[model samples]
Target: MKNDDYSDVVMAALHVLEESGSLPNIERENKCEKRSDKYREEGNIAFKVGDVNRVLEFYNRALMFAPKNSRAIQLAYSNRSAILFKMGQFRACLIDVETCCKLGCPTDIESKLIKRKNEATVRSEMENLSANLLTGYFKDCFKFDFKSNTPIRCASSDIEVMKGDAFKVVAAKDIKVGTPLALEDSFVSSNSEKNVPFSCHYCHKMSEPDTM
Candidate 1:
């Protein structure tokens, strides 16, 4: 009920309990159970709407009311992990997954299987090195070319190639489809005779700077 709904009768009952020092005597467990249920309900609603962060917040509040509440812990960790994973923060996802596991959540076989599937996907993504394969902000890959059989080092030049399409390169590289690259701290020099090597940022193949 809203605060204003506590009419004189409600206040009188509270005052009576206060004077009698019986407020604390009421079972704290019952009060917490009620609040926990309310918070969990709100949290579930947030989860259904894809507001994962807000869902975690509500579940955390429920946990404060019932620290050992299994559902609260499970929902908090699972939702937080999923959001973090989607945001391409796999490192953070790992931590949340561990916490969820340690909290005695996923007691049932189906729940455990679901958690394992999510964990596997995140883990596989974390191990991949290709910038295009990587989701989130890091996936904005630049293009470059490298010499064949050499490592396609990250470069700042704009090089674009369709998948499986090979461009004539001044050099060649051995990197594959999933190499990670960034434009930060990269340089493009105007020197003609320096013979700097470049790589296709998309395919990570080797090429020369002058030819591109």
Candidate 2:
């Protein structure tokens, strides 16, 4: 039978069986278990070939079809969390990891999953910290303090403007020419310059004269 025609025929036959109440009592648990594993295997194959979209689709279907509180459900969540972490969706990955853990993830892989959870948690927290830094009362002056923002750090108190995406920054007071708004130094220091003729390469500091 042609594939398209077969679908319609099967759908009609199944619908009629359902309506007539003649559909045999299939073991739903076994059926769901089999189908979920089948889909998860297909997703794994697609993932191996780097077919990201197809992998996600199959894994999602597996998750939807998986029986509640079943090993299949835990495995599907664990597999999808791997994909989410690879995709840099840390928050989504964390949710899946938590669910898998609650469902009693396989002992063989649980340690690895826990490690992944910790790394993703750190990245998620850093993302939140950055967003908070750039918001609210810190909005205008948020970009000023940087232990490492150099490439540049804002230095002018009169100026309320930030560099990256800010537009109108009117100086609250008259600005002098050559006033430093931001300054950043390269990570490198050298002894080649006259100021430091001989400096340690490690710390870039010149040696002191011998007192003895």
Candidate 3:
């Protein structure tokens, strides 16, 4: 059957199940389980072939069909987390790992999941630290102090903002251009032009460059 047709059928079935306001039909539940498993298996195949994009796609589809609060859903989330980690998407991977934990990973794989979660968390933290440091450095170059207590207050009243907030630099009193607003220290900083021969390009950390 066409993909659209199959989706319509599934949606209709889900609508019927919802309107019933009772336990899902065992047969229908089992079918969803089977389909989820099939997609997961396909994801495994894609992983073996090193097709990262395909693996992620299959796992996502598996998640869509997997029943809520089911082991299959948790497993799918866990599997997807691994792929996200490989892609260097530590924050996204951490989110998936958290979801797996909330859903209760299978006992046999719980330890493995926990390990992945820890790694993802550490990586996410490190990345965040690096980002903050970079941001601080750039702001400092412009002499902008983000932490300074100014008359301007950042508030959020709109849902359109991603963090559900907006920054409003309102002036309750006269402000000067050279006024020190806030002070922040970068996690790591270096003079690139002076340290190029002895620093890492990415982090600007001092390092020995090969003379080859």
Q: Each candidate: what lDDT?
A: 0.55, 0.75, 0.72
Task: Tell me the tens digit of each residue's lDDT in model 2 across 1-212.
Answer: 64555878889999999999999997644438789999999999999998776777788889888999988899999998887777666777898899899888999889989999999999989988887876865665534442323222434455565467656666657877755466546577556543232246677765442200
Estimated TM-score for each candidate: 0.36, 0.50, 0.52
| Model 2 regions more than 4 Å off | 1-31, 136-212
Q: How many times do residue backbones clash in model 1? A: 24
Return the top candidate by TM-score: 3
Off by over 4 Å in 1: 1-34, 69-71, 109-212
Error of 3 at 68 (Å): 1.8
Model 1 over residues 1-212: C-alpha lDDT tens digits? 55766588888999999999888764445336567667878877987897766765675576567546456555556655665555444555566666677776666643653665577566756566454456545444434333323233344122333335665433124545565333345355343221122345454554531222
Q: Candidate 2: what lDDT?
A: 0.75
Deviating ranges (above 4 Å) for candidate 3: 1-31, 140-212
Question: 1-212, model 3: which lDDT tens digit per residue?
Answer: 74546878888888887888754555633438778999999999999988887887898889889988888898899898888787676777778887888888788888988898899889989999999999999777765434434332332121112222765444445656665544445777667453443356787665421110
